[model samples]
Target: MSASSRDRKFPLAIEALALSEAAAPFSLRLGQGEALSLLSEDAQSLSLFCDVLAGFASPTCGKIFIDGQDITSEPPEHRAIVLVSPRDPVFGHLDVAANIALALRAKGAAAQLIDATVKKTLALVGLDAQNGHRADLLTPEQAARLKLARALAGAPSVLVLDGLLNELDLRAASKTRDLVTRLQRALGLTLIHAASSREDALWLGGRIALLDRHALIQCADAATLMERPSDARSASLFGEANLLTGRVLEIEDDVARIHLACGGVVEAMADAELAVDALCILCIRPDRMTPLFGALAAGDDETPPLVATIQSVLHTGEHIRFRLRLADGGEIEMRRPLLQPMRGVTQGALLQLAWQASQAVAFPMKDDL
Candidate 1:
C-alpha cells in the first residue's frame, strides 16, 4: 500500500510529500498536532528538506498537501506552514517586538491586530517583548524563542524547526524540547523537527523519521526503532546496540534459542519464522545485559550464563560502561547503573553476563554485513 493510502482516515497536516535532488527520493506524512523528528546527520540534506517544505526550493517531483489541501505549487506564505531556523532572517536593527510584528505587517494585518498578536506571542514564548531588546543582542536561547514567537505570530497550523535545538546543550535542549512540545499541544500545531543526533531525536520524544541517502529509511518511536530496526544501518544509527550474529538452535512458541558466534546460547523474542540452524542477527541494547558478579545461587533458573572477561571499564556519571571479551574472541559492551554494586568487576576480570529472553531481538542476517 502507498504511504498516503495507509493514513487516509486521519486528518493529515502534511501528506505524500516527496522530494529528490541527486540521490534517492524522500517521502513522509505528518498528521495534525503530531510531531516527527527527521533524523539526518548531513547538513545539506537537512537544509534541502526544510527548504522544500518551506517552499524555498521546489521538489524535483511529487506533491505536498497541507491540511488536506494541495499546496505543492503554493508559496510558503499560503501554506500556513512556518519554518523557523536558528539563523532565520531577522531584522537585526529592530527590537524583539518589531521583529515579531514584521511578518504580520507584511501580511497587511491591522496595526492594532499586529500589536496584540505580537504581545501575546512573545508572552506565550516566555519573552518580554516590551523591554525593547534589540534582536542582535539576544542570547542563543532567547533568539530561538523569538524566532518561534515570530512563527507563531503568523498563526500557522504547522511549524518546521530546522536545527534550532541542536545549538543548545543537553539541559537547554531538554527545556527547549519541553517548551516546543507544550506549544505544539496548546496550539494544536503539527511539528516537523530536524535533529542531528540520536540523543536529540530521543529527547524530542516523538516518532522519528530516519533520513539517509536522500530517502526516508525508517519511521518509528525511539523504543521500536532501537529494538526492532528495519536494517543494520538503522540499528547502528541508534548507537550502542550489540548486533551479534547467531544461528537459530530451536524455536518454542514466541521464543527462539540461538547460538551466538561469541560462544554462548541466548533466547530472544522471535517475531519472524526461522528454521533450525538458520543464521540471523541478534540485537540487544547494552543496558539490557546485566553482569552477574559471581556464580548463580542455588535454585536459579537453568538458563546458562554467558561468561566473558572484562576488557575495560569507563565511568560515565550515571552509569559504568564495560567492554567485555567473550570466550570466542568476540566483544560486547554493557552498561550498569552507578548505584549498582560492582564488587568484583575490574579490567581482565571474568564475569557472567545474562539478559532476559524478551530483551533481545532477532532478524534475518543481511548479506552486506
Candidate 2:
C-alpha cells in the first residue's frame, strides 16, 4: 500500500447493504476511529446487519468497505472484522486466557505477541485475575467481558457488536459499555454497535443509524434525531415524544407556524422544506412540555395552552411522567422532575400544557406515521 493510503482516514462505508429483498438496503459510514451504532426495534434485523458487517451473511445487493478497500465478498477469516453477540459460543475446554489467544493464533500472530495481547486484553476487560479459570465457569458478566477480550485479542479492523451489552444486567451493561468505548478510543478501533433501544444507541454516542423493522429511517447525531427528527417514527423512538398532526400556517426562516388538527396553533422549528398550508406532524418531547401556572406567558394567542386533565402519573425517581387527556379527548404526555413538579400535576387535576417553539420539531405528514 502507498504511504498516503495507509495514513489517510479510512471510513467503514456500507452502500445499500440489504438484509432481505423487502428490507430497505442499509447504508452508513462509520468515520475513522469513532463509534457508530445501528439502532432498531427489530432484534433479528440488527443481528443480520451485524452479520453482514462481520462477513458472516451475504447482502442481497450492497458493498462493504474498510480502509478504503471493498470487503463485500470477503470471508470472515479474511475480513478482519469481529462480531460479539449473545449467541457467541465459548470453548468450555479452553481456559480464559486460551480462549482469547485462539483468535490471535489463527491470524498467525507470534506466540510472544499472542501471550502479551492476551494478558493486556484480560486486564482491559477486568478479567486479568481469571486468566487460568475455566471459560465455562465464568459468570454472565465475566463471559461478556471475555467475549470482548477474545475479539480484541485479534485487533480487528472493525468490531461489530450485536447488543452484546444487553446480555448483562443494567449496572454491568453500563460498565461494559464504558469499557468498550474506552478500548475503542485507546486503540483507535472502528466500532459499530447494534442496539435494540434508543437508550442503548444514545449511550454508544457517535452517529446513530435508526432502523425501523428493517428499513433505514435516518442516520444522524442524537441531538439532531431528538430535536429535529425526520418523521414521527424517528421522534417516537426517542423518549416520550408528543406528536400531533397539523398543517403549516407560515414559514419564518427555519421555524414554521402550525395549526393543529386537534385545536391549537403553535410554532415549531422546521429543518426540512415546508411551504405554507402544507401537512405537518408536530413532535415535542414530554420533558420539554410544561404545565402553565397562574397567568399564561404572553406569546401567540393562537398557540394558547391546551387544557388537559392528568389521567395518570408514573414516578421514575428522577422524573414524574404524566398521561393527560386533552379537551378533544386526545392524550398528550408530560414529564418533569420531582424537584420542580407542576402545581396541579396530580391525577384527575386540570392543567394547561405549554411548550416552547424551539423545543418542537415539524416533519412532513406521512401515511406511515
Residue 242 Cα positional deviation in candidate 2, in Å, after optimal superposition: 1.5
CA lDDT for candidate 2: 0.81
lDDT of 2 by residue, 35-120 (tens): 88887767888898888888888988978887777888989888878999877877888999999988778778999998899889
Error of 2 at 125 (Å): 2.4
Clash pairs (backbone) in predicted model 2: none
Against the hidden true structure, what lDDT does model 1 obtain?
Answer: 0.77
* TM-score of every candidate relative to the true structure: 0.81, 0.87
Put down candidate 1 lDDT per residue, 1-369, tens digits, no spaces: 653455453334344445665555545667767888888768677778788888888877777766566677889888777899855766779999999988788889999999899889988999974449998898777778888899999877678899787667777777778889899888878888888888777765789988776667789998889777776557666745688888888888878888877766888877565567889888788899877775642322434556789899999998999998998888888998998888777788887767888887777776654
What are the clash counts of all predictions, listed in order? Answer: 0, 0
RMSD to the true structure for each prediction, in A, is: 4.3, 3.4
Cα lDDT listed for each candidate: 0.77, 0.81
Report model 2's TM-score to 2 decimal places.
0.87
